[model samples]
Target: MAYLTQPDYVKYICSCGQLKPITSLYFCRHCLKIRCGFCICHEVDSHYCANCLENMPSSEARLKKNRCTSCFDCPSCFHTLSIRATLVQPRQASTEASGDAKVENKQAKKMYYLSCFNCRWTSRDVGIPDQPVASGGWPERTNPFTTRMNQLLEYYKAIALQEKQEKLERERKKFAIRGKYITLTDKTGLTGAMARNIAGLPSTDGGSSSAIANFVASQASEEVEELPEDVYTKEVNLKQITSMAQRLASPEWQPAEVSRLHPLAKLLSVKRSQRCRACDHNLTKPEYNPGSIKFKIELLAYYHVPEVKIISHESMKPGEKAALLVKLTNPTGHEMTIKLLQPEDVPIVEEEEQKSIEKSLEKSLNLEKDSYSWRAICRPASYSALCRVREVTRDFTLAQRDDAAEYDDDARHDADDVIVWRKSNKLALRLEVETEASAASGAPARAALALQYSYRNTVPPAGNQPHQRNHTLYTTVLLDLGHVI
Candidate 1:
């Protein structure tokens, strides 16, 4: 018989080709195979401005390119630009006392500029003027490339028109083979010259005007509207100014100009991506939005580190405690904090071996470790010829039966919630095994131990917001033991 604190059997080979515990393998149904972080591809799709919720399409993105029209980066450090405001006393009218004094306007309402506090990059640096009010109502600037852009746009339009004409010509020829295939002009009792005259397509260019005149005729009308001066006035006083501005304006602030900042700075962008170091696989892409503190997560199939092993045990008498030891290590440079997320929180593995046991014991273990942690799970696997397994236990250590909180829908899952609490690398545990006379023929029985850990990745997101959010890492450890009870 199997006892509590012990598993019935352990798996030998990982779903991947490597020999690892059932815990260390990730089952991928889409690929119908086990995958380690070593094999996958990751790519970034787009970087958007969160405040405006205006995402740029990739093609348009390449041209507008360096800076977003709606979004601005600090010119000094290139960090995402945040809006800031200052209240001015509005120059007080100085000649108010004299009866014959000239009338003075209310202290020419003071004008303050909106600027970036991080790198001393002011809206003024990019020629962004101050607003009359604290928020909104900033002047919009037309692009300087308007003329060249218009020409390019027209060129594409013309090309599209030419392609359409060619397609129509092809269709006409295809249909010509069906019968007499008389041309439209032939059926209508007209020749090519007559048809060209009727269709409005020029057969010759001898009488045409200058190319510039033709271009002018084909071009759309241009109209420019200017905003009234009153529209630039700041009607409302902006009360809250963040400390970021003061920090940015401080003379002490210095940011590195190297490309190394690319990985970290990209996190500030609405959409961020990172490539794996081992295989250069892109592991996570998050949609970072400034207006809201929520984000979208896209976890790639690769990049899951794994652990697998085989455990053996002797015969088991009823009610005896057994123990198994498994070790975990991080292969990446950045610190990774972990927890044992519920099985539902993890993606399903598609292997048949993974599905053999339905409802295998599992639970979330609240953790508190920073880069690494250790804990134990207690279970009994004796009488039913089946093994009982539980999730990796951390500090939370709930009982066998208790209701736990379900994961909330917040776009941001706090990093502090799932870390494990461990002062040292070592962890201790006890397992009990029981045996029955029928199976006491002296043959050793076997059981499997499954362990899971959920961790937070230290890598930063790819776009503008480097510190926006954290990526959760999940891994499993498996051990199998056989011996007498």
Candidate 2:
């Protein structure tokens, strides 16, 4: 079991050399390897508003600047703003003729405004008119430099396109070979520029050249504006002035005064899926519905990998042996035969299998030879040199997990020195740790161990071949012992 405040006692080594708890690791069924965040690919699946639970397409979200149109955040405290409604008497059409009439006869109208309960801030505080509808009628403030910003954006986009075209042309020239016969288009005087124009695309140089020529650069001014004479002598009112955080919340117009602040549009949240970089197989994918927190596919390591937890350990002294108790739980449904070995004694990947994995990765992901994923797969497991695993020659079998067996009090006790106790699929073992003689006092004590276990492949066979039930796999773990006395 892991605690929030306590440090991790046992950590598994990922394929990419990262040490993480099993809860934070992922198992790729296709690759049959343990992967961490550094060795996987993340992709955004969808965007939605957390407040309204409203989903929007990628194009729509981009157009709206990745913010929810209906939902807003408070400018004062940066909290989600709630819509508040008020009933107000409507103005009389002919107030002069009905001056003697009672105002109670007039009909009342419902109006809505944004309110922040946390900070007690309201839209009326900034002189914003109440909306007739409860949602989505709030007035939007436009940036005064919107036109200039658009021009700058267009100019940069054109420059990027021009650079990309030039790069492609250079690469083509380097790889192209002279042809004896000319194409029909080339013979008919239909150049690439004309073809692009015919396809409704901008001409190669004309569009970018024109944009670059039309761009206007801002000039620096020599004159400086003078501040008010009472600027330093005036008594400051902090309540009226906005703080840096409040002003920066809206980057377009950073309001210096509290009265100039407005409700900010709430940013959109994304639902992303993770995929194994080597196999291109999805590790986890969430449901499309914004309201559902469940995932459609989740291949977490907790379900497939055996979990090892440090139950208790004795204090360690230099060049002395200490007793360690570790609990191992088989999470899989199939019975597993586990053997503990030294970290260095773990078997290396066979040449044939390694070549096959490389080929598969190349076919699936089109990865380069020097890519990070390829390197991680080819690299060997790394462990600290200060720690060594005491060899345990015994092999134990753990029964398949049974949910009903957890309630039973009967636990089969094996008459072995290593096996302490055994339940349904969990067992506790007593192991001895020999500290290095050169280990210094007050230094961290760590022990490295490797597990070779049998795993049952539940996925269906690709062809008409029979199911391959069991396969052997290896994993290494590091245990943190208390500091040496």
Candidate 3:
């Protein structure tokens, strides 16, 4: 028999039907099947300050609450204090004669103060005890707002939830009375109340009078559930909490201006996740850290806007029609609709034989520079003379601007990136011609190509974002002069 490899030890199935690496999956012998970080429970084995790394026993840790005993947040700005120490000279126990005798003294102990540079907060200023070590010796503080804020927040949350339940009940009744269909509960031999109970919601058929009275009693009670004493001991200093509240409430406050900060702030920003590559179960969040780890969340900046640009064809023969193209792209994560318009001077026209070229040329040609001239004759010499050119435009969308974005403007002339030329809106010209007809035999031809393009983009604001106009107009045209061939 041939021995088989362990079938990729890293690849394993979790209880939640998600395929994840063994590194990300944990084995729960009790649960049998593989357990991923997402499906398993997280119980903190110990409580310790990140700065001190001194693990404390559960019972003792509970006594001081979960917070570190030696550390404290700045009351003014809530930043962790950095302990600093200085050495001092020790005095001898007995005095020695200046020149006759001398005595050896013991080494002196140094004292230092911990300070918060961001908020100018200091431990010495608040009367915290000095520690032998420079780090891991901070004082802990308790927040006074803890009780009131918790009570207020819970009260509003409960009120909102109760309102939602009431609205859902009304909607259910309306749909039920329609009689067009039977609900799953009705077909399963269960009443709506029974289903609601199974779903963990309170029964809705209690007497109106009793329900109203019960609701009133519940709302009148202001008491909030108390946290476990051990958890409760993890108190936040009132001063620090107050400072944070003020900063949050002030519209003018900027995070850049605030100084004091916890050292682990960046570590908290690291996003750790365990995902089941196969099933994508617990789809919203396949991996989550235990409640013990206090994770931090923040928004940096939003990137959502459409980008656009234009390109023009190189200089063409004096009598030939010039062509140009415009490209638009959406650099944002969302899709966008856009519109483009041709410049006023560059009107859309169809190809046609030249008409009254003599009159048109007479109006455009400059007599002062008429040393030479050039002319374009249609395949059939009988065709009418060409006088002006026509313009054209198109529309499209671009996906997110990732690393692959590339810009190509090879067709544009060296003189200018933009161009503008006049033409009839309804009629297309075979081509526009501006040549110096020789006042005498064969003169030299010299003329400039003038072109310009104009356009508009339409995009809607994202949800709840304030209505604001955001679009840019790029206008530039090139004028190149060359000898007529």
Q: Which prediction has more favorable TM-score, 2 or 3? A: 2
C-alpha-based local distance difference test score of model 2 = 0.85
Candidate 3 displacement at residue 300 in angstroms: 15
Model 2 alpha-carbon miss at residue 188, Å: 9.4
Quantify all predictions' global Cα lDDT against the true fold.
0.41, 0.85, 0.39
Residue 30 Cα positional deviation in candidate 2, in Å, after optimal superposition: 0.9
Q: What is the C-alpha RMSD of each candidate to the true structure, in Å?
A: 20.9, 4.0, 25.7
Model 3 lDDT per residue over 1-485, tens place: 24253232122333333444433544321111234443422233445555555556668766664566566555455566666677777777765686666677898898777777786766555456666776454444445556665555555666666677789768866777443545676445687778788999977644433434444222566788886877666866554343445354332332222233222110111123322222222211221333335433211111222222233333434445444333333444443433333223323332231232233334443321221231221111121112222332332233344443344322322233222321111111122334333222233222221222122223344478654443332211222222334
Q: For model 3, what is the alpha-carbon lDDT of residue 324?
A: 33
Instruction: Give the winner by TM-score.
Output: 2
The number of clashing residue pairs in model 3 is 20
TM-score of 1: 0.33
Task: Please give each candidate's TM-score.
Answer: 0.33, 0.88, 0.30
lDDT of 1 by residue, 60-137 (tens): 666654235544544345566666656556554657465676756564354556556775556664455577765446
